[model samples]
Target: MDNFYLLLYLSVAMFIGSFVAGLVPLAFNMSEGRTRLLSTFGAGLLVGTALSVIVPEGVEALYIVHTEKYLPGAVQNKDRNQIISNSLIQPVASNLAAKINYPTYFGNSVVGKGVVEQMQQSPVMDKKETDEYRHSEASVNFNAINQSIGYSLVFGFLFMFLIDQISKYLSSKDGDRTHLKLTATVGLVVHAAADGVAFGSASATNRAGVQFIVFLAIMLHKAPAAFGLVSFLLVEGIERFRIRRHLIIFSVAAPVAAMVTYYLIVVVENDKSSTDSATGTLMLFSAGTFLYVATVHILPELLGSNVKDYQLVNSATEGSSRGYSESRASLKLIELISVIVGAISPIF
Candidate 1:
């Protein structure tokens, strides 16, 4: 089907996943153990998606873009000619050439005849053109492009890290944890938007596999992330209606961002090289962002390092001491398993 339609479908799926995740805790109060398990599973999925799927694909896509953009047309033409001459079946080679649409080999060897005629007509003009082409070609360096992508990956990671840090700082300052909760929600909203961009960019590639994996990765985290956000607000004594509004906004953010980015890249730019480069950078950036969230933000909370500071733990402790500790240990084991399963799920 159409790539745009696929993107829209994925965006709607993301919204539903996030909305359900947030709604569950509000509808029925979830135990802390269950919440931790879900968060851990989501974290595992993000990590798995990043390392196993996103980073590798980003590198491969960028490499292909670099090769296509920088490689001289003459070299491609020469390669095509060599393949045609060496082929045992002339018709098969001819058919392959036609399918590939090799400009040099198409329509009575355009490259050869055209070059010969041009050279015969004006040697000085041809010489000047060749010199100019070589000079311009020298500027399209792969090293620079690779470096830019690397920097973008780092920037992506750092951007999320900054957001997390700011949220933490705001929470620490606010006695009621209201500011902290809101900050965290806002940060996540921004992340969801970034996830949308990643989705849109991947869809633009027109590769079903890439689109599927990316969609799965985003969906896996969206619900759990929303659940965490709404759960935090609920714990902070925020009204249910207000929480729902926040969830609605959060759910819509990513799809809207994805649609906008997709439209810009696919419709506005309309350049294949630009699309590939932008897509690759966005993927790498997303990988970095996912890495930070999974490892730094989610894992520590699941492991109970911040349990004492959590409202759920404090409230649960006020009721029963023995049950909380036992549940925590059991839940930790469950979290480990969930994380393992999440990380490996994409492989199959």
Candidate 2:
């Protein structure tokens, strides 16, 4: 199937999945234990996808771009010869003949031909010339492109951090949690757009299974995120209509961004190398954001103290210490296993 059509299908799936996930909070009262498990699992999926899929895929795409760009071929060999004849050998020989008053001797019609011929025939002259030239050219590009990738990753991470901090600040200042919820929702919407960019880039690559895997990883986390967002808004006493509006906005963000980004990338006619480079940069940036969301936003909630669990433990009978400790240990074990499984799932 065409990548455009494939992306369309995945975008629609994401839209519906997210919308339904948001509605889940309104439909059911989710248990604290179940919510934690889902969140932990989603965090693990983000970690697995970023480290195992997006980061490595981005690096490989760039590597392929440069490798193809610099590969020595018949055309490159011909160009190399012309460059050596016109630039390197001719300049030196012409100067030498002119200084010695032998213009005719080293002119284009005379010793210049002999000089070029001799250099071309020498075994050592062009033996590894193509390899060296390719290396030099590739090195400059690789360094610059690598820097771009690094900067993009850092930018993504910092962007999310700033969003998180702003939400926290607003939440601290306001007595009502509504503003904080809205701010956080905005952050998630932006992140959803970033995920769309990743999806679009993967589609641009036209690689089998690449876009599918990215879509799967995205949906896995996005569902839980959408659910959590609606739940938070509800807990903050936001009106049902307002919650629906937020859900709709969040649900549409990724699909619209995915279609727009994919169209922009696919419609513009550019060289394959440039497309690959762009795709790689976007993928790495998405990976960085994924890392931030997984580590800073999601995983910490699981690893840190739980107010619900603390309350439960406090309310337990004094004689239930052994059973309480054993149950706590079991819950910890379950959390660990869930995370490990989630982290490893993307590899398959």
Candidate 3:
């Protein structure tokens, strides 16, 4: 396909995918118990995605840091008069090396042994591609990806947390701590948010297929998340109109973020070396955002003591182990399992 047609189609597809995944669920009518189950599953997905995708990759990106600093110097030899030299650097898992520190099997891996040492020479095709310009380009793209994720996480979690605090404040002053309801209003379209970063990076990496995958994943999950929000709103005693409004706002935030990220990708690609500043800053922010989501948005609901007591009453105290209070606990269990399933499944 021609470039303009391809670009137009991709943009349209992305928008449609976001809407389908993120907006449709808000219109559904579902039980709080079911919503809880799905939400827990979603949480698990988030945790799993973060730890499995972002964290390990982030740590792996540390390999680039070593390469940029140490390997650049190490690649130098007295042989050729050329100022530039090339070497393949692989990411060695320090975490694994800590375990296999025996001298016999893993020769003095006190520091760390290379797990993916592509010690084999470079491919013929790579001989030309490994020149300064491509190196510089890849380096820049890597920095941008690092920064985009960092900033997204930071802003995302913090954005959610700030609203959570607002909800808490309102609940406290009204003598309704139990009613501190945050019904997926802050940044409910999580798939869109995730897709935004993925899309941007995919564009930079020229991985259009990867972007399509993200589009599909986001479409699959958004509806459930929106439904969860609606149920949460019911629990919080919100009016129907307000619930709809919340859903609309949450649904759209993701697309806007995605578009913004796309522009960022374009800009960052222009000059690769300038990525460190943005990437470093954004990464710190993402840490804060994830922490807030765990502590404020997800954890509080899961950790309620009354939920456990009610479930105990339902199951142990009587023949039936369900009650009004037990409802939350029951939902919490489903949520937990779903989360584990979504998060851990990806690892396998």
Best by lDDT: 2
C-alpha RMSD between model 1 and the true structure: 8.8
lDDT of every model, 2 decimals: 0.69, 0.71, 0.46
Task: Give lDDT tens digits, candidate 1, residues 245-287.
Answer: 9899889998998899889877888788887877788878878
* TM-score to true structure, per model: 0.73, 0.76, 0.51
> Tell me, what's the RMSD of every candidate?
8.8, 9.3, 16.2
Off by over 4 Å in 1: 72-140, 174-178, 306-331
Model 1 clash tally? Answer: 0
lDDT of 3 by residue, 160-279 (tens): 555545543444455542344431354344434644454344333333543454344344345555555555566567777776676666566555665566567445446543343333
Clashes of 3: 16
Q: Rank the candidates by TM-score, best first.
A: 2, 1, 3
**What value does the lDDT take at residue 194 in candidate 1?**
79
Evaluate model 2: give its lDDT.
0.71
